[model samples]
Target: MFNKILVANRGEIALRVIRAAREMGVKSVAVHSTADSDAMHVRMADESVCIGPPSSQQSYLSIPAIIAACEITGAEAIHPGYGFLSENAGFVQVIEDHGLTFIGPTAEHIRIMGDKITAKDTMKKLGVPCVPGSEGGVATLDEAKKLGAEIGYPVIIKATAGGGGKGMKVAQTAKDMERAFQTARAEGKSNFGNDEVYIEKYLTTPRHIEIQVFGDGKGRAVHLGERDCSLQRRHQKVFEEAPGPAISAEERARIGKVCADAMADISYIGAGTIEFLYENGEFYFIEMNTRLQVEHPVTEGIFGVDLVREQIRVASGLPMEFTQENLKINGHAIEVRLNAEKLPNFRPSPGRISQYHAPGGLGVRMDSALYDGYSIPPYYDSLIGKLIVHGRDRPEALARLGRALGELIIDGVDTTIPLFRALLEEEAVQTGAYNIHWLEHWLETNLGEA
Candidate 1:
């Protein structure tokens, strides 16, 4: 294995990589912006580099700065812990050009899966199920209107390069088509620099299911079951559970094989997630994430494996440690995001954390960067931590999650902990019958209940 690797992100994810590296006897180099000078990851890594100021463009997202950090630290590889340049194909190429290794999928794979239309087309060609809609980008209003009519009402317009619900809009009828199409295109341009939009049949009651697949660059690959990330707000996932409460063993095996086969066909490498919309016992491809996901802990909890360690081992040209037959789902696991945001309005709340206490117990894992005196800077994501619980079954997992949430405490800033606490009381959430739209509807009617 390489002696060192650089973690190219911040917050809890950066610390996740650093800890994984440390366990494998690999030193880590952490690159941070000025705002994160006193961050946990920076303090834990074997070496640290101040990349730039608080601005992400000049700091966390700066290619030259990250490359310079790797050079100065003699880091042999980079582990991009999601977001920023994690899916940027150009950054992967640059690392290779500098004679450094990138601990993820090949640039070609990233390029193919980065664009929505291309990925959908690719999945279709590979015999994976997909939502019915436009075959490609709709360049003009006339074409969009024509396609919308043909696809039927309640279709959604999405940017080819968009994510996080920024460039996605749904139109219930022809009259709403023009606005949604234009707004989706504009949001796409402003958020991702790609105005190209495509239409897809919107599954109103589908659940968000993502299959986690890992490959060894060669043609070998395996799937680690699925995570139900249906709970979200403004397109950001808040709660995720593994071995989807709604999926059966047969369905899990079938879809798991499909995703693993697809990754093997492309010779994918490292960690990747293929997201789908599941409804009425059928699965439709949505998009694929080419890096580790924020909710990966739930998967790890049930599988009894270290994904980060596996990612690093694969990146170092090692064969996979286990086969599909060797892997088994041990139990049910649930993960709830803990963000520093005020409820009701969901506004950002950043300030010093006067008091902090992490829940401790069996099957409970808290991955956070918060401290008693650390002042949360206003320059980054509102997420402060993730609380995960694993139990022998779904009911036990839910109970553990409730107990754990009750024990967590953070002062001086409003958080979303109460939101999750309220969710546990809902019959829909309790029975695992909640759909993608469940959280929004719940928030609308029971805004103050949490």
Candidate 2:
């Protein structure tokens, strides 16, 4: 076990790591920017250091400043909680080069899986299912048209280098393929710094399902199960739950086994998520998140496991204490992300928090850094907190979540609470018949009425 570890992020996740480290009897050092001088994570950690100014490029994302903090604190490892440098392959290599452990996957695994195109190729080679697409980057307009025709109409042109929902476009007719191809290529070059593009068959109504896998360094891997993250907006997940109502036990077993095998084939280490788009009884690999996800607390609640602790144990050359047989998911769990945004249209609303109060009860859990008089800076993510609820069944969980959301109150900023409240009462959510587009369609119908 590491005597000390430095956390390379901010907000609730930073505080989350600090709490876990303290419970395990490990010292934690928190690195923060000038903007977060009095943040909760700084106050909770065993030690703190100010890296730089408020801008992410100069502060949270500053590689040299972070390494200096770790060296000065004599920390043996670093835990990047989600965003920022969590998935940066270069950062992982730098940490290893400095003889410091990065508490995630190896640099090789990160490099192979970081790029979207490379990841798709690797999954296909490993016998994992992937969406039918271009074999490599399309070199000419003729190649794009030929590929589009073979894949059928409504194909999505995507950047082979990077993604942000940018450098991507869809064409429904053959006549429009040439124009869309040029536009996507230009956008990709401007946004991602790469003009390479590929085409893939796009599903109009697909559900996003991801399997969570934990692996030790020596080729031992197991999956904790899957999460249904279909409730999203503009590719950003808002609500998530465990044990998707859409998948059966047989289907879950098949997908979980394949995901575990794929991770082992890549020599993947630590905790990671293998994402898939489930549409017609088949799972097609989309991408793999090489770090802990934002909605991981729901999985922890149902399984009664400490993922952070497990991550540390694996990085320290210790075998996982629990196996596939020992793991058992107890019940239904749901997490509603509370962000500083509007109800229907999620526009950022950042300001001071006047009255702040979180929900409480037997099955309710709140993870946040919110406090009275705290000002939400506009320079960072708009997330305010996460409300997770667990119950013996889906209905019970939904009801508990409704009650919890009703209890939550935050004044002086627009929030998504109204939207969640309306959603819990909708007939689709009550019967679990809603797909990925349900929320967006519902929003369009009741944009401002809620």
Candidate 3:
């Protein structure tokens, strides 16, 4: 076990990793930017260091600064709690070269899975179902048009190195193919520094379901069930639930086993998620997240396991304490992100939090770093906290989540709380009958009233 570890990010995820490390008797070092001087994670960590200013490029994303901090603190490992450099293959390789363990997958695995084109091809060879499209990246607009025509109308163009809905476009017909291809390529180059784009037969009304899998470096792996993340806006997940309400127990088991087997086949290490799009009782591979996901809490709630702790253990050369048989879904769990943004417009609201209160009760968990009078830095994501609730079933979980959301309060800033309050009452959301496009459609139709 590592004696000390540096948390290489900020906000609630940094705090989340700190708490988990404490539970395992590991000391934590928090690295923060000047903008986060009063951040809760820095206040709670065993030690803290100021790496740079507010800009992410000079601070949270600075590899040299983080490496220097680790050296100065004598930290044995780095736990990149999502975002920033969590999925950067170069960052992983550098940390290992510095003789520090990265509490994630190997650089080779990250490199392979980080690229959408290679990831899809690998999954296809592993017998995982994939959406029909071009065999590889569509390098030219002509090729994209040819592939789009062959795959039929309504295809999606995606960046090979894209995420969070960036570098993605949809073409409903051949006329739209040229613009979609150019836009996707330009955005991919701008955002991920790669102009590689791939085409896929877009599925309408598909549900975004992902399976959480963990593996030891030497081929042993297990699945902890699935999370329904269909509630999204602009390709970012807004709400998530465990034991996806749309799939049956048999379907869940089959998919989970397939993911575990695929991980073992590649000798994948640490924690990763295999994301899929589901429609008409069929699952198609979308992409793989090479690090812990933002919506991982829902999976932890149902499985009664600390995923961070497991990541640390496996990274420390320890085998998982349990097997697939030892894992069982206990109940339904739901999580809603409390972003500091306004509904309808969804504009970022960054300012001081005058009054902050979190709901508490049985099966309700709040992961946040906000406190009264803390200034929210606009340089980071709008997410201020996460509200998670567990219950015997989906209905019970929904009821609990509604009650908790009502009790939670944050002043001096616009938030998405009202949006969720309204969403909880929607018939489709309550019945779990919505698809990936449902949220966007709801926003267009109901944002005025909300």
CA lDDT of 53 in candidate 1?
98
Candidate 3, superposed: residue stretches over 4 Å from native: 448-450
Across 1-450, the per-residue lDDT of candidate 3 in tens digits comes to 899999999999999999999999999999999999999999999999999999999999999999999999999999999999999999999999999999999999999899999999999999888999888888999889889889998999999999989999999999999999999999999998999999999998899999999999788889999999999988989999998988999999999999999999998888899999999999999999989998899999998999999999989988887799989999999999999997679899999999999999999999999999999999999999999999999999999999999899999999999989999989999999989999988888888521
C-alpha TM-score for every candidate? 0.99, 0.96, 0.99
lDDT tens readout by residue for model 2, 1-450: 999999999999998889999999999999989888888898899999999999999999999999999999999999999989998989999999999999999887887787778889998888889988888788899999999889998898887765446787888889989888999899889986889988888877888899999988777788888999998765678889987889888998899999888887777888999999899999988888899999999888888998998888888788888888888888999998989996556889999899999999989999998898888888889998999999998899999999999899899999988888988988978877767777777777889421
Q: Which candidate do you rate higher for lDDT, 1 or 2?
A: 1
Q: lDDT order of candidates, best first? A: 1, 3, 2
Of the candidates numbered 2 and 3, which has the greater lDDT value? 3
Q: Cα lDDT for residue 126, model 1?
A: 81
lDDT of 1 by residue, 1-450 (tens): 999999999999999999999999999999999999999999999999999999999999999999999999899999999899999999999999999999999999998899999999999988889999999999999999899889888999999999888899999989998999999999999998889999998887999999999999899999999999998887889999998989999999999999999899889999999999999999999999999999999999999999999999999999999799998999999999999999898999999999999998999999998888988999988989999999999999999999999999999999999899989999988999988998988898888422
Clash number for each model? 0, 0, 0
